[model samples]
Target: MTNVQLGAPNFRIVSTNVSGEASSRALFGVSYGLGMAATQFALIPLDDERTLYKAAISALWTRFETENGVAEGRKLALVNVRYDSESINTFFYTKVTTVVVADVVEFE
Candidate 1:
């Protein structure tokens, strides 16, 4: 049997989402693995609340060659935005800050 293992992407990615959905968008990308992000927001008079979100994601070195966005993280998700400061407040509120990028290998 052949032995093979994939190494994690060498990334110090510091992404700041703007107007994307509280729900993650799956776009094909070069990098693939599991991940999560911290989404936060505030109420008029109540304290801030946070939730955890996790999903399969990828980070591409470049955009996908094709238009089909089947693969996750094919491209960074985009949403409506006016100013950079309103990015966090426009989406779902959560504290999911870390996404564990990994692969699932099968033995044959």
Candidate 2:
């Protein structure tokens, strides 16, 4: 039960694939908890829908590091950093967001 930090060169991107099934990438290295969330608002019917959610998740991770100081400027390892997205339809196409939550851990 040891505490680990982020920013450590412990994680590495293994592979990335985009297809009809699912677009995702895999990372190899240590294990750690990396939680993320994304949100977006759309006005026009046809527009770039991926960028907004990506930005949101990025911001969420940044904030998590800044606030929790889990892996801030430290050699912490991470693996299998996955990304997923969903839509929230209410009144109108107002917003969309995505969240990625993972754990960074090292095996003994």
Best candidate (score: lDDT):
2
lDDT of 2 by residue, 1-108 (tens): 866555555554322221111111212211122244443434444434455445544555565565445555554344455566554445543333355544444332
Clash pairs, model 1 backbone: 27-74, 28-71, 28-74, 29-74, 35-99, 36-99, 37-96, 38-96, 39-94, 51-94
Candidate 1 structure, TM-score to reference: 0.19
lDDT scores in order: 0.26, 0.41
TM-scores of the candidates in the order shown: 0.19, 0.36
Candidate 1 lDDT over residue span 1-100, tens digit each: 6334336543222333311112222122111123233433333313222222222122221122132234354323322222211121223331213232
State the weakest 10-residue window (summed lDDT) of model 2: 18-27
Best-performing candidate as measured by TM-score: 2
